[model samples]
Target: MSKQQMIPFQTTLFVKDTCLCLHAQRAARALARLFDEALKPHGLTNGQFSLMMSLNRPVPAGMADVAHLLAMDRTTLTAALKPLERRGLVIVAADEKDKRRKVLRLTPAGEVLLAAALPAWRETHATLDQRLPDIERLRADLRALS
Candidate 1:
């Protein structure tokens, strides 16, 4: 048989667009870019801002706890934190209760940076909210999906 005759093809027109994932991905990328641009003056990426915010709790927390809270793997969290640690924005030390586990805490400098980044973050957040007034509904929908 010829190649065209040998091959079989199925045709269907009911493939509905499940573009929710794509839309979410694009929105995430765009938001990240906006945050990155706003945070540039403070030398922080959106991820770093998130990490710092996560660490801002009253008590120091174990790396495992942070990983769980951030929905990030330990290795990935460690890699992301390295720059902050190196820059004196964060401190990683052995957990007081469990010597084998590491605890993460924000340093004074980290607090300072977070404070500086807050205004920029708020600005970007407000701008996005104003531009996309449906964000609250979208956030609710996203949370429902999660």
Candidate 2:
């Protein structure tokens, strides 16, 4: 038999052009940069804004729920919370119903900050939606993929 043929460079280009994961990652980075710039006035990166937003609820949320909702592991979620806690924007305490379980809550300060941040996020997201029509459907599709 002939020597095994080497993998072709064309295959590399094929994957680069055709891979959904690659395209999704690139789009995610681009969107992150856009939102980061938009939210800079509030001293929040897009990730921090999203993390804080995840805690906006009628009740203090459990770490696991927030982590799962954010697609983050508990360790990563804990690390993400540290800066916000240091800033006194969020508090982590034992759950009332289950004392051993730590729950996350936004403080009054955090609520104020988030309220201020909302307009920027809304405008930026609206602009993005304008550029990408049917964005709600796109969001639903992306969620399905996730």
Candidate 3:
């Protein structure tokens, strides 16, 4: 088979400049870092805060539903829950209505912690929204991609 031509640095630069996924990923990491830092005093990272928030509900949420909402697989969701469980912030149990399905619930401590983290999350989120004009449009576009 003929050898493929080597790609040039200019093409790589063009890809970096124009790729939607690359830009989205970079923005996501940056935003996560900013929120993570903002949440440090509360002893939570952005991901943990999101995971906890996802479980906020009157009824415990099912594992598959949580995983789908988080855009993560079941295995990854399990790993993420480990630390929160250890901290007594989250409790996963068999769904009362359906014994086979595992349900996610925030413990009393988790509710308290999430309550405390809300102000921090709100502040950081507002800053992000202010920094990025047309944030609502951007979110809609991003959701379209998903």
Candidate 4:
């Protein structure tokens, strides 16, 4: 390749050090692992826990709404629901008023497990919150980015 087509090694180093996406992804994975380990006894991953938590409302949440709240596309959210559905932890069905629309809800067993898992989730979050400086601000910034 010609020099014009080459990206300098220094540029790679700069991106490695300063890319927000890279940093955020690395942090996300690490945090997922931490929470995954904490939730293992409950047979839930961090993502699954969050998904179930999203469905813990009085009314079954619309699939699109849950997808938006979780920052996931419908297909990805549907794929993620497979294991939970298989375990009877969540129910996905067509909305009553709109047959074409889908909705989701946690089962009674899922609620019980979520209640049981709350302490571990709280403790992990508390530890992370204590370790991070100005976590609220960090969260706000992340929200803004999203």
Candidate 5:
């Protein structure tokens, strides 16, 4: 493209400064990094922590329910569960009542890990909440957007 026909560099600056999607993505990445670091000692990523947490319930959760709650597709959720399943931290099995459906539950080992990881997660969130001007509103806005 000729120099005269090229998009202006100022347009790039405008997007960097004002794009909501860009800002949200950057913030999400930053938050993920922080949680990843906090959960690192437990051999968990933020995504894994979230996935496991979604299965914490009185009954084994259906794969579809867990997938929806985690904002992931069933394929993605299934892939994410493999390492945890291999480690015996989680169990994925066919529902006895519905042979075609899969359900997920945390094993005793998973519960123990989650219990241990809770304090670290709590502490990190507390420190982060103190820094944010309005965490509740930010969360609500994010939920609405999602």
Candidate 6:
């Protein structure tokens, strides 16, 4: 084929020189879609599931701490929490010690929803593991990047 004809019609550029970011983003999006479908019955999106899981571990986490752990900016995290708050799945309250700070906690309803979603999550995770046996390696690589 001539050089002009061989060239692709369109080329997409990622934000950076590294493919790692793009690959991770694409993988996360795909996984989120799959988990979203699986968690639909429990009325939880993958993001909500993750947030609940994070809050389930401890009693009331400061918003900043939770945001840091989730690697999300405060604004973005606040936006994500709105739906959960509306659904009564989570509660956000001002920290008593510091009125300016907010704390996040999973409500009883959130716990129940998380419990209902766990089986679906496990099945999806297992399927992914079966498909990507090298996931551990990928995880290690990703950790190294971090």
Candidate 4 contains a number of clashing pairs equal to 0
Model 5 residue runs over 4 Å out of place are 1-4
Model 5 lowest lDDT segment of ten: 1-10
Which pairs in model 6 have colliding backbones?
Answer: none
Q: Rank by TM-score, descending?
A: 5, 3, 2, 4, 1, 6
Runs of candidate 3 with Cα error greater than 4 angstroms are 1-4
* Candidate 4, residue 83: lDDT: 96
Full-model lDDT, candidate 4: 0.95
RMSD to the native, candidate 2?
1.8
CA displacement after TM-score superposition, residue 73 of candidate 2 (Å) = 0.3
* RMSD per model, one decimal: 3.6, 1.8, 1.3, 1.5, 1.6, 5.0
Residues 6-65, candidate 2: write the lDDT tens digits.
889999999999999999999999999999999999988898899899999998899999
The TM-score that candidate 2 achieves is 0.94
The lowest-lDDT stretch of 10 consecutive residues in candidate 3 is: 92-101
Clashing pairs in 4: none
Clashing pairs in model 3, backbone N/Cα/C closer than 3 A: none
In model 6, the worst 10-residue window by lDDT is 7-16
Residue range 1-120, candidate 6, lDDT tens digits: 665645333433433445776878897899899999999998888988998898986569988888988889999999999999999999999998999989999999888889889999
Alpha carbon deviation, residue 26, candidate 6 (Å): 1.9
Worst ten in a row by lDDT for model 1: 7-16
Off by over 4 Å in 6: 1-18
Q: What do the candidate models score in CA lDDT, each in turn?
A: 0.88, 0.93, 0.95, 0.95, 0.95, 0.87
Q: In candidate 1, which residue ranges exceed 4 Å CA deviation?
A: 1-17
Cα misplacement distance, residue 136 of candidate 4 (Å): 1.0
* Candidate 4 lDDT over residue span 1-146, tens digit each: 66567888999999999999999999999999999999999899999999999999999999989999999999999999999999998999998999999999999999999999989999999999999999999999999999
Question: Could you tell me every candidate's TM-score relative to the true structure?
Answer: 0.85, 0.94, 0.94, 0.93, 0.95, 0.83
Query: What is candidate 6's CA lDDT for residue 21?
Result: 69
Q: What lDDT is reached at residue 81 by model 6?
A: 94
Whichever of 2 and 5 has more TM-score, that candidate is: 5
